[model samples]
Target: MLRLASSFLSVPSSLPHLLALLLALLAPAASAMELGIDRLESRGFDSLKGKRVGLITNQTGVNSAGRRTREILAKAKGVNLAALFTPEHGLDGKELAGKYVANRKDPVTGVTAHSLYGPTRKPTPEMLKGLDVLIYDMQDIGVRSYTYVSTMARCMEAAGECGLEFMVLDRPNPLGGLRVEGPPVEPQWISFVGQLPVPYVHGMTCGELARMLNDRKWMSAQCKLTVVKMQGWERPMVWRDTGLPWVQTSPNIPRADSPAYYVATGIVGSLAGLETGVGGPNPFEICAGKGVNPDSFSNTIKNLGLDGVQVRPYTAGGFSGCRLVIDPKAKGDLCVLALALLVETNRASKPDLFAKSPADKLDIFWKVYGSTTIRDQLRQGTSVQKIAQAWKPGVEKFREERKPYLFY
Candidate 1:
């Protein structure tokens, strides 16, 4: 597949470079990726010395060595670590999705922890008071609706508002960087969920996104923004190649494949008003919903002969509710599966129901797909192939537009 045997060209005969590379190449599966901040010596954490900093992160902010960032920064020479700000999942990563987290003292560091996901999902002028710079170093699930991207955007805006500097310690997008899928969100439908026009699966890392956001008008002109880029990462390398650990960014994303399936089945679950199995052992693996026939729906999709994925039946109840099967192979084609599922389900269900009145449960979905094309196509009984064909030009155009921003 993506063999890199050429990595040995730089090695000297006396050195064990090839051996090391071979060992790495042969490394056991599930080894974690070494992220940007993990290479602290190269990235220069010392630049943060003497700065009264407020950090925006959650459990995924651990150092490569598994130490917490606040702990490391506090012990480092000259760092005046003052406060901590948490995102959607809260500081400890224990809070349920969308739950409010209030300000409290971190039991270990005693740093005042502020909740960015509570009443305000952004740092207010008061929140940024006395802070020299606001540093963001969280793992993003790489989806437009994941909320971490929006959190970073708000932090950048607040930095501008209060004349504070914003630094983004980037991390991989988990879904890899080969392609940016789905449609760019319409600015009018922008919410805390999504504040920009980026596609559903933006292939760039957090640092690259910060650079793009720094040029946008939504940010305060006065704020100085900087991104510490990831080393040895390229646009084509997915999370599997990163040689680092997996830390769950959100409660539902328990594994790397979760985000991959999220791009596809997640959309289907949400649009159909079904249980996405977020809280289960395999979040995206479950695709059941209320009033849905899991077997029939699964058969319909299987009969469509869609490439690169399979729909398996499943059932959920008690809080999760009813559902359908899953596409375990749905790694790179989440949006494709989303469109396919929508198109197929409509043909088997009552005709034109979605066309008469499309579901508007989450504006974020509509924003990304660009004008409800998936739902509209389904309602009109359009074939899955036709709808996918229609999205080709838009997907290609978006991939081209995001070329400059690509980072592995």
Candidate 2:
């Protein structure tokens, strides 16, 4: 077990080149990739055998074969599934965002399921009682401020405080692992949305982030940590490349490709008076606002020459703008695309979008964007290119700092 842990920690410095070569060699068998849950099951639940386990999961926590991890562990021969925990949207993934979910008995497993999104965000010592290990298994959209990763980090801290083992069942970052973008969270602005000090589009998986959090002492305490890594997943492979089924991560993120769109326009949506297709068919896929002409907006975005993205005029409800068609494989910074959209909206709208926005909304905007710098730059007429350049140092620093934590 010590040897296995050491091997997981010792990443070779030439990992990038080696990983590219490995991907080329394993192209044919890419579809045969096994998720962390699948690998854990195949190992006969060795790490969890005869242990009382608590699971932090939602609808996205499923094996590649479509079995829920909660159900799997409940019936595993020697594994005693003691408790269950739900994050933002609740266990069923149907609860509305930010709505409090109460603790209840899980209808399927009859386990006492706790709510991490309720009055208390972290599990208390009483909640950790009788549990030997806490396992985390949820699919994240690969963007910061999504809150699931925050819940994971808070849970890790709780587990550490309780001196319990914390295990992460690794999953692939749907946006791929090479596309790190946006600024790191500043110390003063860290909140539930931006818990970790990583980029807005930090491309590492939940397991990698967990390892970084543990090793860097980002958490209050260090727990005995283990990550059941996936088999055949590589850094360059996006969701489609993995051949895994897509489960709706949340209400807005209803598809595998939804994360890319989220990155493109989520920041813009945080401000007032713009609709990013929240209630429409294409959530987070369009940038629209009142009094804006769809053709002009679409043409403006198209003319930006942003790689990996195509734009078309789209009108929905009372708003009109462009529907973004994002190609995740191509070289493009989604964060820059968001900034451009904001700038264009400010120019097209009657009053400045940033100036007219309420203070609370602007606070949410800064929180999601990781700083007040971009908002200030936009209000002062700083171009998106200049803003990107200014934050480039922080993003580049994060890219280099994150190399050792990456598993693929």
Candidate 3:
């Protein structure tokens, strides 16, 4: 047993100044992360002062004080807040992933809201006719499959087509802005979910991504783009380190840790054709499909020496499967859990969860993973380590290519 006082650094009361300094050092560190919206407000939202402004945001588009962006803009002095737009989730952030949300009026701001994820993904000429500028402020995970970036890309193109300006109030990339993973999407596999030819985990905020789209000509057309760079955000900080409240970006991602799990198991649920807690509070973390025994699976996985994650039998209310813990103790990539899960599950034989062949289901599976070859390799019983090795070259090339556009 260890004594509590053994590791203590003693303070000297005889040296009063030194004692005060020690106390200060022991205090919790304060965070100074001001969001882009907060900075925009401080500057008096000057860009929208005399313009007919159309805002594309959701419930996650709020400031540090938890005030909705449109509410503040609609009531701000000198700003002509015209209309509102929403993406895959409605303005409320209640809609499920891949489901189309119908356009509805916002009760708070009383603006005519259009559903961009519905009938027309890209804004129509009518939507842009009277607007001088389009401002977008949506919180997004730094993944290619998430539709928010795709929505922003379309809006930029539409604004350019109608001769209007577009601006993005940057948000933090929750996965941080350093690691780039997975395969670069081929042109033929491009869809609403994965439009840009980036990896599954492209580590850039919305503003940076918009700039890349314009510079790289990823969008159909280019607009006069402006990015409101976030103050006090660094490239190395994750969401928890930023000290801001975690607003649910979607019904599925209810907490901060959920996005990481989604990257690992969400696609597994989709390809396997199982219920991934769509309406429930917790999603993507549930291991309740046609699963093997919890104890056996967990022991085997733990013994495999998987990096950056631990698995244990989770049993509650007659349900049992392993909980894939993003093991904080391990000095390994946090994404290892996702990669290892795919590999382990692929090796084990179980009931066929896919109603059709994975090739037939590439339309859905390819959204997140962004490669038909990955699906085919899994089908062919290829090891996950081998697959990762094959993709390492592409991942390295992308990291260098995206360096010029880094904004944190």
Candidate 4:
């Protein structure tokens, strides 16, 4: 027994290597992706030493190993995690959009959980008491209209007001950092959804946005902000490429395919022009409603000669609508696909024939879009090519402006 123990202690590193090699040969290739939480845990939570942490996250905050961010924090070496804060969705992320989630106690950690989407959308001074740092870690769907961005901005403002050190555990944009689309929002039209004057698909991660927000002084005060960047990520890689797990960002936007098509479909859905499969199994993946002939619509979009994607008559769950099937591996510009559909749609579409959702439901898609120029251009029958050319300058300027804030 003494000799066996001695052999094990001496070959500790070799034994793990042999085991890993055997497992690698037996199983399929696993992703080598490392998320922000992965780096934080592996490197030891030195930055959080003796600090009472308050996390603003949800079910989406998980490492590549499927460990919850809150659980990782609760068990970290030096972490004094004191509170939990949830954004638009509740702690469990089951609450519907625009619904209020009240403050509750976390059964796992017993920490007080504050609902940022309840009566107030931002954290108040009372919520920050006794917490030394506020940590944010949630996967953003890569759209400006998503409430996560607004929640982050509001928290930044609160951190400034209450003198709290804030840090963000950066996640991949999921939409990647390239491919930006849509018109820059007008200042007056800005709201919680369009927190900043950015294009619809800003193509930025939450960490980059946090840095830009601080540098632009969008926050009330200049709070000490630290963004824990991802180690193995780059600008060109999307979520699927990263090999990280996907949690539904929202009820409608479930898998990666949903967000990839959301910005494009949102252009029509916001105007009450069409229904984009909200209550179905494939939400945000199908566009159908009154006046839509799937076969005709599919042929028209295909005739437009869009690259990297195709249109097809998609029928599922007793509904017949068209889906813009994007090849995940295709390197074509996704932003253009939506524009092509819109342009082709106007040629034969009666915008007046579009159906509208009930008022009680969360129906401010037009407000979420926040671009009168695009809407008016589409309404007046502008060519898709001409409309695409118009927004080139703004997108270029935004890309240049955000360069200094980019980490990966």
lDDT, candidates in the order shown: 0.69, 0.89, 0.77, 0.78
Model 4 C-alpha lDDT per residue in residues 247-289, reported as the tens digit of each score: 8877777887677777667656554445577766766666665
Output the TM-score of candidate 2. Answer: 0.91
Q: Could you give candidate 1's per-residue lDDT for residues 153-257 as a string of tens digits?
A: 888888887888888877877776765667556656677666656777777788878777776465545368777767667666666667666787778887766
Candidate 3: which stretches are off by over 4 Å?
1-29, 273-278, 303-307, 315-320, 327-331, 334-336, 347-362
Ranking by lDDT: 2, 4, 3, 1
| Deviation of model 1 at 39, angstroms | 3.5
> Residue 194's C-alpha lDDT in candidate 2?
90
Worst 10 residues of 2 by lDDT: 5-14
> How far out, in Å, is residue 231 in model 4?
1.0
Q: Deviation in angstroms for 197 in model 1?
A: 0.9
**Between prediction 2 and prediction 3, which has the larger lDDT?**
2
lDDT of 3 by residue, 1-408 (tens): 246444343434446776788999998777687888888999998878889999999999998788999999999999888889899988999887768889788899888898998899988998777999999998998878888999999999999889999999888888778757766787877888798888887778899889888999988789999998888898777788788889999888888767676766766665653434556666766554344566775786677675766666765555455676663223344444555655555444364443333664547676666766765677777776687777778888888888788875
The C-alpha stretches of model 1 lying farther than 4 A from their native spots are 1-34, 41-44, 218-222, 271-273, 290-296, 303-308, 315-332, 346-375
Supply candidate 2's per-residue lDDT for 43: 94
